[model samples]
Target: MLKPHQAKQAHGDSPNPVLSINQMNLVYNSTRGPITAIRDLTFSIRKGEFVSILGPSGCGKSTLLKIVSGLLRPTSGNVVLADVEVKEPRPDIGIVFQQPTLLPWKTVLENVLVPIRAMRMPVHEYKDRAHDLLRLVGLGDFINHYPYELSGGMQQRVGIARGLIHDPAMLLMDEPFAALDAMSREFMMDELQQIWMTTGKSVLFITHSIPEAVYLSDRVLTLSPRPGRVIDDIKIDLPRVRDVETMGQSMFGEYATHLRALFKSNTAPSTRIA
Candidate 1:
């Protein structure tokens, strides 16, 4: 395994990226004085690429996501999306968090239409799109069902549908499947890959699971422990259309092993939660 400081560096920004995170740093003033969450972090997500982030807990994975989503600003550096600097929440991007955050009273279709309504677009025009997204996520038969009627996995399916309703330029997922049981998490990984294959939207996924990240992403970016920096930008060369069976392959284990080693060597106190 490469040491944290010696891991492969990110490539240059030649081909235009859909999202560019340039040497980002974030610091907070607290009772303990100044705390740095990220340091000199830099990366780029090309059009239609699926990239996953892995690091120790409190390593600013979610913080980086928020910066890219325009919900939070970085203390230094900048995030540029589609040639425009992201200064505020963008209408062209969608975010799915660990929690589905669905409204219990609303039906699945209604929840999927939330973005459309929030954007002040005619809800009627997006009704068909909502139904199609639900179907794509394998919830066609449950459109009218309420969140209370669904299981944890099903509700997350609804969340995925909701995120895609706007036909956004990029999808930002912050461990969207972290709450599910093992079987369901694996199941959702497959579903997400299929959805990505069909839509070809750029994705920036944050997760602690090495296997999950390696299985779903075209590349995986491993960050150092807090004051996070990109230590490794390893490419996943696995064949597309992967399924659960793909996990049985040697290369799959190789990729997962490499990530685990990076974490073990990168973080001080020498521990990884997942």
Candidate 2:
């Protein structure tokens, strides 16, 4: 495993990133006391890069996503996006949570169109695009169906489509398939890869599954427990093109085992209950 400082020295000095964080720190102020979830962390993700952050439950992985999406601010550091500081929620960033969080009454097409409508963009311009996104997620025949009519996976499909509607520069996803069955979770992984390949979008995906992270990301960032900081940032050496067959290969198993052990032996306390 590469050391944290070495990883930073190698990947941090370069500059082709869509977003960059330098000496980042995040502390939650509560009535009890000040809690530091993340501390002096630093990393970068280049354009079109797929980065996965995996760690134990209280490692502040989701908290880091909040910072990147501009939903929360770092206490003493900066989050720079496309040469600008993210002071507040901007339309250019799209976020998807663990649950689908879709509007139950709206049909799939309507849900997908909400982002475009919220941005006050011409609806006509995205009508076909919306259909195209629905189709891309294998939901072409379900466009008019209401959220209640669809399965957990299908609703998530709609959520994915909605996130991409605005053509955000970056996508932040937090355990979006954690609530699904194992089979559905694997299916969602494939769907996400397809979308990422087609859109070439920069993505920061958070998950606790080592194989999932190793399979999906170009690079994986592992953090310590509370006051989480980089513990390991290893490149998945398996090939550029990943699929079921890739999972069977020895290299894939090696990487997965490596990551699994890294997390197992890691002892980071929870700053906040998840």
- Over the full model, what C-alpha lDDT does candidate 1 score relative to the true structure? 0.88
Error of 1 at 132 (Å): 0.4
Candidate 2, lDDT over the whole model: 0.84
What local distance difference test score does each model get? Answer: 0.88, 0.84
lDDT of 1 by residue, 1-274 (tens): 3333443344635388998889889997889898898999888889999989987789999888888888889999999998999989988999999999999999999999998899898999999999899999999999999999999999998998899999999999999999999999988999999999999999999999999998998888988888888878877888989987889988888777778887777764644322
Question: In candidate 2, how many Å is residue 149 off?
Answer: 1.2
Give the CA lDDT, 0 to 100, for residue 7 in model 1. 37
Q: Candidate 2 residues 1-274, lDDT tens each?
A: 4433333322653477898887899999989899899999998889998988887887788889888888899998888887788878888888888998888888899999888888788989998989998999999999999999999999998899998888899999999899999999999899999999998999989998888898898888888877888878877666766889989987777777767766766752343333
The estimated TM-scores of all candidates read: 0.94, 0.92
Residue 49, model 1, lDDT: 92
Query: Between which residue pairs do clashes occur in model 2?
Result: 225-268
RMSD (Cα, Å) for all candidates, in order, is 2.7, 2.9
Q: How much RMSD separates candidate 2 from the native structure?
A: 2.9
